[model samples]
Target: MKFNKKIFNLSAWITLLIAYVLPYQSQSSDGHSTYLGYPLSFLTINNTPIYKTLFMTESIDIFTLTIDILIVYFVMHFANVYLSKVKLNKGMNKTKDFK
Candidate 1:
Protein backbone atom coordinates (compact mmCIF):
# COMPACT_ATOMS: atom_id res chain seq x y z
CA MET A 1 0.00 0.00 0.00
CA LYS A 2 1.10 3.56 -0.70
CA PHE A 3 1.69 6.00 2.15
CA ASN A 4 -0.21 9.26 2.57
CA LYS A 5 0.84 12.70 3.79
CA LYS A 6 -2.12 13.35 6.12
CA ILE A 7 -1.38 10.21 8.11
CA PHE A 8 2.19 11.34 8.60
CA ASN A 9 1.13 14.87 9.49
CA LEU A 10 -1.30 13.67 12.14
CA SER A 11 1.17 11.24 13.68
CA ALA A 12 3.95 13.80 13.62
CA TRP A 13 1.81 16.27 15.54
CA ILE A 14 0.97 13.59 18.10
CA THR A 15 4.64 12.71 18.53
CA LEU A 16 5.50 16.34 19.09
CA LEU A 17 2.75 16.65 21.68
CA ILE A 18 4.15 13.64 23.51
CA ALA A 19 7.65 15.11 23.49
CA TYR A 20 6.64 18.45 24.98
CA VAL A 21 3.74 17.37 27.22
CA LEU A 22 4.61 13.89 28.42
CA PRO A 23 5.85 14.27 31.99
CA TYR A 24 9.29 12.84 32.55
CA GLN A 25 11.27 12.62 35.77
CA SER A 26 13.97 14.78 34.24
CA GLN A 27 14.78 16.37 37.59
CA SER A 28 14.83 15.62 41.32
CA SER A 29 13.00 16.98 44.36
CA ASP A 30 15.94 18.83 45.92
CA GLY A 31 15.32 21.96 43.79
CA HIS A 32 12.18 23.67 42.48
CA SER A 33 10.94 25.05 39.19
CA THR A 34 7.68 26.95 38.58
CA TYR A 35 5.18 27.34 35.77
CA LEU A 36 2.29 29.25 37.35
CA GLY A 37 2.67 27.51 40.73
CA TYR A 38 2.90 24.04 39.25
CA PRO A 39 5.69 21.78 37.93
CA LEU A 40 7.11 21.99 34.45
CA SER A 41 10.03 20.36 32.67
CA PHE A 42 12.79 19.04 34.91
CA LEU A 43 16.58 18.85 34.50
CA THR A 44 17.46 15.26 35.19
CA ILE A 45 21.10 14.20 34.73
CA ASN A 46 21.89 11.64 37.43
CA ASN A 47 19.86 9.01 39.27
CA THR A 48 18.48 11.59 41.69
CA PRO A 49 15.74 13.74 40.15
CA ILE A 50 16.52 17.40 41.00
CA TYR A 51 13.33 19.48 41.06
CA LYS A 52 10.19 19.87 43.18
CA THR A 53 6.88 19.15 41.46
CA LEU A 54 4.64 21.46 43.50
CA PHE A 55 4.77 24.82 45.34
CA MET A 56 7.44 26.02 42.89
CA THR A 57 6.36 25.18 39.37
CA GLU A 58 4.07 27.15 37.09
CA SER A 59 0.74 26.00 35.71
CA ILE A 60 0.03 25.05 32.12
CA ASP A 61 -1.63 27.66 29.93
CA ILE A 62 -3.69 26.51 26.97
CA PHE A 63 -2.57 29.37 24.76
CA THR A 64 1.07 28.46 25.18
CA LEU A 65 0.20 24.86 24.42
CA THR A 66 -1.68 25.83 21.25
CA ILE A 67 1.25 27.83 19.96
CA ASP A 68 3.62 25.02 20.81
CA ILE A 69 1.43 22.61 18.86
CA LEU A 70 1.49 24.80 15.78
CA ILE A 71 5.25 25.24 16.05
CA VAL A 72 5.78 21.52 16.31
CA TYR A 73 3.50 20.83 13.34
CA PHE A 74 5.34 23.27 11.12
CA VAL A 75 8.73 21.94 12.15
CA MET A 76 7.70 18.42 11.25
CA HIS A 77 6.17 19.57 7.96
CA PHE A 78 9.35 21.39 6.94
CA ALA A 79 11.49 18.42 7.89
CA ASN A 80 9.34 16.15 5.75
CA VAL A 81 9.76 18.53 2.84
CA TYR A 82 13.51 18.60 3.36
CA LEU A 83 13.69 14.79 3.41
CA SER A 84 11.62 14.57 0.23
CA LYS A 85 14.02 16.92 -1.51
CA VAL A 86 16.96 14.83 -0.42
CA LYS A 87 15.31 11.63 -1.66
CA LEU A 88 14.90 12.91 -5.22
CA ASN A 89 17.20 11.43 -7.88
CA LYS A 90 19.53 13.97 -9.51
CA GLY A 91 20.44 13.47 -13.16
CA MET A 92 23.17 16.10 -13.66
CA ASN A 93 20.72 19.05 -13.34
CA LYS A 94 19.31 19.25 -9.83
CA THR A 95 16.96 22.19 -9.08
CA LYS A 96 18.70 23.24 -5.84
CA ASP A 97 21.95 24.05 -7.70
CA PHE A 98 20.35 27.02 -9.50
CA LYS A 99 20.35 30.53 -8.01
Candidate 2:
Protein backbone atom coordinates (compact mmCIF):
# COMPACT_ATOMS: atom_id res chain seq x y z
CA MET A 1 0.00 0.00 0.00
CA LYS A 2 1.09 3.55 -0.73
CA PHE A 3 1.29 6.29 1.90
CA ASN A 4 -1.16 9.10 1.27
CA LYS A 5 -0.34 12.52 2.67
CA LYS A 6 -3.94 13.68 2.40
CA ILE A 7 -5.16 10.78 4.50
CA PHE A 8 -2.43 11.40 7.03
CA ASN A 9 -3.32 15.08 7.35
CA LEU A 10 -7.02 14.34 7.57
CA SER A 11 -6.47 11.77 10.32
CA ALA A 12 -4.30 14.19 12.27
CA TRP A 13 -6.95 16.90 12.18
CA ILE A 14 -9.72 14.46 13.04
CA THR A 15 -7.80 13.11 16.01
CA LEU A 16 -7.07 16.64 17.24
CA LEU A 17 -10.73 17.58 17.01
CA ILE A 18 -11.76 14.46 18.86
CA ALA A 19 -9.21 15.12 21.58
CA TYR A 20 -10.32 18.71 21.90
CA VAL A 21 -13.97 17.85 22.31
CA LEU A 22 -13.39 14.82 24.51
CA PRO A 23 -10.77 15.20 27.25
CA TYR A 24 -9.75 13.22 30.30
CA GLN A 25 -11.39 14.76 33.35
CA SER A 26 -10.86 14.09 37.02
CA GLN A 27 -12.06 15.63 40.25
CA SER A 28 -10.92 14.83 43.76
CA SER A 29 -12.28 15.78 47.15
CA ASP A 30 -8.72 16.34 48.35
CA GLY A 31 -8.64 19.58 46.32
CA HIS A 32 -6.71 18.10 43.40
CA SER A 33 -8.11 18.26 39.90
CA THR A 34 -7.14 17.50 36.31
CA TYR A 35 -8.60 18.25 32.90
CA LEU A 36 -6.27 17.12 30.16
CA GLY A 37 -6.94 17.62 26.46
CA TYR A 38 -5.10 17.27 23.20
CA PRO A 39 -2.74 20.20 22.41
CA LEU A 40 -4.59 22.42 24.93
CA SER A 41 -7.37 22.28 27.46
CA PHE A 42 -10.51 24.16 26.61
CA LEU A 43 -11.24 24.59 30.31
CA THR A 44 -9.78 23.36 33.62
CA ILE A 45 -11.15 23.54 37.13
CA ASN A 46 -8.67 23.07 39.96
CA ASN A 47 -9.59 23.14 43.61
CA THR A 48 -7.13 24.14 46.32
CA PRO A 49 -7.57 23.68 50.04
CA ILE A 50 -8.44 27.32 50.54
CA TYR A 51 -10.51 27.77 47.43
CA LYS A 52 -11.87 24.26 47.41
CA THR A 53 -15.27 25.41 48.58
CA LEU A 54 -15.07 28.84 46.97
CA PHE A 55 -13.80 28.51 43.42
CA MET A 56 -11.51 26.63 41.02
CA THR A 57 -8.38 27.24 38.91
CA GLU A 58 -7.43 26.45 35.34
CA SER A 59 -4.21 25.17 33.67
CA ILE A 60 -2.84 22.95 30.88
CA ASP A 61 -0.85 19.71 31.14
CA ILE A 62 1.36 19.45 28.07
CA PHE A 63 2.73 16.01 28.80
CA THR A 64 -0.66 14.36 29.12
CA LEU A 65 -2.00 16.26 26.12
CA THR A 66 0.89 15.10 23.94
CA ILE A 67 0.37 11.53 25.02
CA ASP A 68 -3.34 11.78 24.39
CA ILE A 69 -2.77 13.16 20.90
CA LEU A 70 -0.30 10.42 20.05
CA ILE A 71 -2.64 7.68 21.27
CA VAL A 72 -5.64 9.01 19.36
CA TYR A 73 -3.57 9.54 16.20
CA PHE A 74 -2.30 5.96 16.20
CA VAL A 75 -5.77 4.53 16.77
CA MET A 76 -7.20 6.61 13.95
CA HIS A 77 -4.35 5.62 11.63
CA PHE A 78 -4.91 1.95 12.35
CA ALA A 79 -8.63 2.19 11.62
CA ASN A 80 -7.97 4.12 8.41
CA VAL A 81 -5.46 1.55 7.20
CA TYR A 82 -7.72 -1.35 8.08
CA LEU A 83 -10.72 0.15 6.32
CA SER A 84 -8.70 0.90 3.20
CA LYS A 85 -7.51 -2.67 3.06
CA VAL A 86 -11.04 -3.97 3.41
CA LYS A 87 -12.19 -1.68 0.62
CA LEU A 88 -9.33 -2.77 -1.66
CA ASN A 89 -10.09 -6.40 -1.01
CA LYS A 90 -13.74 -5.87 -1.86
CA GLY A 91 -12.79 -4.21 -5.13
CA MET A 92 -10.41 -7.04 -6.04
CA ASN A 93 -13.09 -9.62 -5.28
CA LYS A 94 -15.55 -7.76 -7.51
CA THR A 95 -13.06 -7.71 -10.40
CA LYS A 96 -12.38 -11.41 -9.95
CA ASP A 97 -16.09 -12.17 -10.12
CA PHE A 98 -16.44 -10.09 -13.33
CA LYS A 99 -13.53 -11.97 -14.92
Candidate 3:
Protein backbone atom coordinates (compact mmCIF):
# COMPACT_ATOMS: atom_id res chain seq x y z
CA MET A 1 0.00 0.00 0.00
CA LYS A 2 3.01 2.23 0.33
CA PHE A 3 3.94 4.70 -2.39
CA ASN A 4 7.12 3.07 -3.59
CA LYS A 5 9.01 3.97 -6.73
CA LYS A 6 7.70 0.92 -8.52
CA ILE A 7 4.06 1.80 -7.87
CA PHE A 8 4.61 5.42 -8.83
CA ASN A 9 6.32 4.42 -12.05
CA LEU A 10 3.56 1.98 -12.91
CA SER A 11 0.89 4.61 -12.41
CA ALA A 12 2.88 7.06 -14.48
CA TRP A 13 3.06 4.59 -17.32
CA ILE A 14 -0.68 3.94 -17.12
CA THR A 15 -1.42 7.66 -17.20
CA LEU A 16 0.75 8.07 -20.29
CA LEU A 17 -1.06 5.22 -21.97
CA ILE A 18 -4.45 6.76 -21.23
CA ALA A 19 -3.39 10.13 -22.59
CA TYR A 20 -2.15 8.50 -25.76
CA VAL A 21 -5.24 6.40 -26.19
CA LEU A 22 -7.69 9.28 -25.69
CA PRO A 23 -6.80 11.64 -28.50
CA TYR A 24 -8.28 15.15 -28.60
CA GLN A 25 -9.78 16.33 -31.86
CA SER A 26 -9.91 20.09 -32.30
CA GLN A 27 -12.57 20.59 -34.95
CA SER A 28 -16.19 19.71 -34.50
CA SER A 29 -18.26 18.36 -37.37
CA ASP A 30 -21.21 20.38 -38.80
CA GLY A 31 -20.37 23.41 -36.68
CA HIS A 32 -20.84 21.38 -33.52
CA SER A 33 -18.51 22.24 -30.67
CA THR A 34 -16.07 19.54 -29.61
CA TYR A 35 -13.73 18.89 -26.74
CA LEU A 36 -10.79 17.06 -28.20
CA GLY A 37 -12.72 15.59 -31.24
CA TYR A 38 -15.93 14.40 -29.67
CA PRO A 39 -19.04 16.38 -30.58
CA LEU A 40 -20.78 18.26 -27.79
CA SER A 41 -24.10 17.29 -29.26
CA PHE A 42 -25.23 15.62 -26.05
CA LEU A 43 -24.85 18.74 -23.94
CA THR A 44 -27.15 21.73 -24.36
CA ILE A 45 -24.18 24.09 -24.23
CA ASN A 46 -22.81 22.32 -27.32
CA ASN A 47 -19.55 21.42 -25.66
CA THR A 48 -17.70 18.19 -26.24
CA PRO A 49 -17.09 15.84 -23.36
CA ILE A 50 -13.80 16.22 -21.58
CA TYR A 51 -13.18 12.49 -21.58
CA LYS A 52 -13.19 10.55 -24.84
CA THR A 53 -13.19 6.81 -25.18
CA LEU A 54 -10.78 4.72 -27.22
CA PHE A 55 -11.53 3.72 -30.87
CA MET A 56 -13.65 6.87 -31.24
CA THR A 57 -11.22 8.78 -33.39
CA GLU A 58 -7.84 8.38 -35.06
CA SER A 59 -6.39 11.84 -34.53
CA ILE A 60 -4.84 13.01 -31.27
CA ASP A 61 -5.32 16.39 -29.63
CA ILE A 62 -2.10 17.32 -27.87
CA PHE A 63 -3.64 19.92 -25.57
CA THR A 64 -6.36 17.69 -24.16
CA LEU A 65 -3.97 14.77 -23.89
CA THR A 66 -1.60 16.84 -21.80
CA ILE A 67 -4.42 17.87 -19.50
CA ASP A 68 -5.53 14.30 -19.00
CA ILE A 69 -2.01 13.12 -18.23
CA LEU A 70 -1.48 15.82 -15.63
CA ILE A 71 -4.80 15.10 -13.94
CA VAL A 72 -4.05 11.39 -13.76
CA TYR A 73 -0.59 12.01 -12.42
CA PHE A 74 -1.88 14.14 -9.58
CA VAL A 75 -4.62 11.69 -8.67
CA MET A 76 -2.19 8.79 -8.59
CA HIS A 77 0.27 10.71 -6.47
CA PHE A 78 -2.41 11.57 -3.95
CA ALA A 79 -3.66 7.99 -3.84
CA ASN A 80 -0.17 6.74 -3.16
CA VAL A 81 0.28 9.17 -0.31
CA TYR A 82 -3.05 8.24 1.24
CA LEU A 83 -2.36 4.53 1.00
CA SER A 84 1.08 4.90 2.55
CA LYS A 85 -0.31 6.87 5.44
CA VAL A 86 -2.95 4.26 6.12
CA LYS A 87 -0.36 1.48 5.98
CA LEU A 88 1.93 3.26 8.40
CA ASN A 89 -0.90 3.76 10.85
CA LYS A 90 -1.85 0.08 10.69
CA GLY A 91 1.72 -0.98 11.28
CA MET A 92 2.00 1.28 14.26
CA ASN A 93 -1.16 -0.18 15.77
CA LYS A 94 0.10 -3.73 15.31
CA THR A 95 3.41 -2.95 17.02
CA LYS A 96 1.68 -1.28 19.95
CA ASP A 97 -0.58 -4.31 20.46
CA PHE A 98 2.44 -6.64 20.46
CA LYS A 99 4.28 -4.52 22.98
Candidate 4:
Protein backbone atom coordinates (compact mmCIF):
# COMPACT_ATOMS: atom_id res chain seq x y z
CA MET A 1 0.00 0.00 0.00
CA LYS A 2 1.14 3.52 -0.71
CA PHE A 3 2.02 5.91 2.11
CA ASN A 4 -0.49 8.64 2.79
CA LYS A 5 1.01 11.83 4.18
CA LYS A 6 -2.33 13.31 5.21
CA ILE A 7 -3.29 10.34 7.35
CA PHE A 8 0.12 10.28 8.99
CA ASN A 9 -0.02 13.97 9.78
CA LEU A 10 -3.54 13.79 11.14
CA SER A 11 -2.74 10.81 13.38
CA ALA A 12 0.38 12.47 14.71
CA TRP A 13 -1.50 15.62 15.59
CA ILE A 14 -4.28 13.67 17.28
CA THR A 15 -1.80 11.62 19.28
CA LEU A 16 -0.05 14.75 20.51
CA LEU A 17 -3.33 16.38 21.43
CA ILE A 18 -4.45 13.39 23.45
CA ALA A 19 -1.12 13.13 25.20
CA TYR A 20 -1.23 16.76 26.29
CA VAL A 21 -4.90 16.99 27.15
CA LEU A 22 -5.01 14.19 29.71
CA PRO A 23 -3.04 15.23 32.77
CA TYR A 24 -2.69 13.90 36.30
CA GLN A 25 -1.67 16.23 39.11
CA SER A 26 0.26 15.11 42.15
CA GLN A 27 1.45 17.02 45.17
CA SER A 28 4.09 16.11 47.72
CA SER A 29 4.19 16.91 51.41
CA ASP A 30 7.11 19.20 50.86
CA GLY A 31 5.04 21.57 48.73
CA HIS A 32 6.30 20.19 45.46
CA SER A 33 3.72 19.46 42.82
CA THR A 34 3.73 17.91 39.36
CA TYR A 35 1.37 17.57 36.44
CA LEU A 36 1.86 14.21 34.80
CA GLY A 37 0.28 13.25 31.54
CA TYR A 38 0.21 9.99 29.68
CA PRO A 39 3.91 9.34 29.00
CA LEU A 40 5.26 12.67 30.32
CA SER A 41 5.07 15.41 32.91
CA PHE A 42 3.89 18.77 31.63
CA LEU A 43 4.40 21.04 34.62
CA THR A 44 6.07 21.28 38.01
CA ILE A 45 5.36 23.79 40.76
CA ASN A 46 7.44 24.31 43.86
CA ASN A 47 6.34 26.39 46.80
CA THR A 48 8.96 27.82 49.10
CA PRO A 49 7.95 29.92 52.06
CA ILE A 50 10.95 32.20 52.22
CA TYR A 51 9.24 35.49 53.03
CA LYS A 52 6.16 34.50 51.06
CA THR A 53 7.22 33.31 47.63
CA LEU A 54 5.94 30.86 45.01
CA PHE A 55 7.75 29.46 42.03
CA MET A 56 6.25 27.67 39.06
CA THR A 57 8.04 25.70 36.40
CA GLU A 58 6.99 23.86 33.28
CA SER A 59 8.91 21.28 31.27
CA ILE A 60 8.25 18.49 28.82
CA ASP A 61 9.48 15.03 29.63
CA ILE A 62 11.31 14.18 26.42
CA PHE A 63 11.71 10.51 27.22
CA THR A 64 8.06 10.01 28.03
CA LEU A 65 7.01 12.11 25.06
CA THR A 66 9.09 9.93 22.79
CA ILE A 67 7.58 6.80 24.28
CA ASP A 68 4.09 8.23 23.97
CA ILE A 69 4.64 9.06 20.31
CA LEU A 70 5.95 5.60 19.58
CA ILE A 71 3.07 3.96 21.39
CA VAL A 72 0.52 6.04 19.53
CA TYR A 73 2.22 5.39 16.20
CA PHE A 74 2.19 1.65 16.72
CA VAL A 75 -1.44 1.65 17.77
CA MET A 76 -2.42 3.72 14.76
CA HIS A 77 -0.40 1.47 12.47
CA PHE A 78 -2.08 -1.68 13.74
CA ALA A 79 -5.52 -0.12 13.51
CA ASN A 80 -4.87 0.98 9.96
CA VAL A 81 -3.66 -2.49 9.05
CA TYR A 82 -6.72 -4.12 10.57
CA LEU A 83 -9.10 -1.76 8.81
CA SER A 84 -7.40 -2.24 5.46
CA LYS A 85 -7.58 -6.01 5.80
CA VAL A 86 -11.28 -5.84 6.59
CA LYS A 87 -11.90 -3.63 3.60
CA LEU A 88 -9.91 -5.91 1.31
CA ASN A 89 -11.84 -8.94 2.48
CA LYS A 90 -15.14 -7.21 1.82
CA GLY A 91 -14.04 -6.27 -1.66
CA MET A 92 -12.87 -9.81 -2.38
CA ASN A 93 -16.18 -11.29 -1.21
CA LYS A 94 -18.09 -8.90 -3.43
CA THR A 95 -16.00 -9.90 -6.44
CA LYS A 96 -16.49 -13.61 -5.69
CA ASP A 97 -20.27 -13.19 -5.52
CA PHE A 98 -20.29 -11.34 -8.88
CA LYS A 99 -18.15 -14.03 -10.47
lDDT of 3 at 82: 85
Root-mean-square deviation of Cα positions for candidate 2 versus the true structure, in angstroms: 5.7
After the best TM-score superposition of candidate 3, give how far the Cα of residue 3 lies from its true spot, in angstroms: 12
Give a tens-digit lDDT track for model 4, residues 1-99. 556566667666765676547765666566465565555554445554566544424456667666665666666777898998999999999999988
TM-score of each: 0.39, 0.59, 0.49, 0.65
Q: Write candidate 3's Cα lDDT for 67-96 as tens digits.
A: 555556567778878898999999999999
Model 4 vs truth, CA RMSD: 4.6
C-alpha lDDT values of all predictions: 0.48, 0.62, 0.52, 0.64
Per-residue CA lDDT of model 2 for 16-82, tens digit only, reads: 5765477655554564666645544534566566644533466545565556555666666688889
Regions of candidate 2 where Cα sits further than 4 Å from its true position: 1-25, 32-44, 47-56
Q: For model 3, what is the C-alpha lDDT against the true structure?
A: 0.52
Instruction: Count clashing residue pairs per candidate.
Output: 16, 0, 3, 0
- RMSD, every candidate, angstroms: 9.8, 5.7, 9.0, 4.6
Best by lDDT: 4
lDDT of 1 at 32: 40
Off by over 4 Å in 4: 1-8, 28-31, 39-56
What digit string (tens of lDDT, one per residue) describes model 1 on residues 1-99? Answer: 334568456854564456445554443466443222112232222322447553333345555455555555566677776776767646335666783
